[model samples]
Target: MSTPELHWFKSSYSSSNEPGDCVEVAVASAAVHIRDSKTPHSARLAVAPSAWVNFLAVVGERR
Candidate 1:
């Protein structure tokens, strides 16, 4: 089966002036998708919604 179209949004950290240094996010069902803005058509990393939250928490704690 083919993948459905997803509504993607740019990361807040992504600047309009930047090209390759960008990230896009999309949420589908219970999974979150992350793709490189420069190669959006390529494969994206998928993570569980809960896992994504945990990942963000770790990143936040490190910051």
Candidate 2:
């Protein structure tokens, strides 16, 4: 399947001066897109909404 067009967004923790460490995300029709902000043109990972929520929950617990 072809990748869907996405409008990516970065977390508030992202910094313009340290773009390399930033993680960008986008919501598409069937999945969520995740890619490095420093290399947006590179390959991205897609995750289902349920998986994304679980991942975020884990991340939140670590924070």
- Winner by lDDT: 1
* Candidate-wise lDDT, in order: 0.86, 0.84
What range of 10 consecutive residues in model 2 has the weakest lDDT sum?
11-20
Can you write out model 1's per-residue Cα lDDT over 1-63, one digit (the tens) per residue? 888888999976566787678889998887999999889899899999999889888877876
RMSD for each of the candidates: 2.4, 2.6
Candidate 2 whole-model C-alpha lDDT, 0 to 1? 0.84
Off by over 4 Å in 1: 1-4, 13-19
How many clashes (backbone atoms < 3 Å, residues ≥3 apart in a chain or on different chains) does model 2 have?
Answer: 0
lDDT by residue for model 2 over 1-63, one digit each (tens)? 876568989965466678578999998778988988879999989899899889888877877
Clash tally, candidates in order: 0, 0
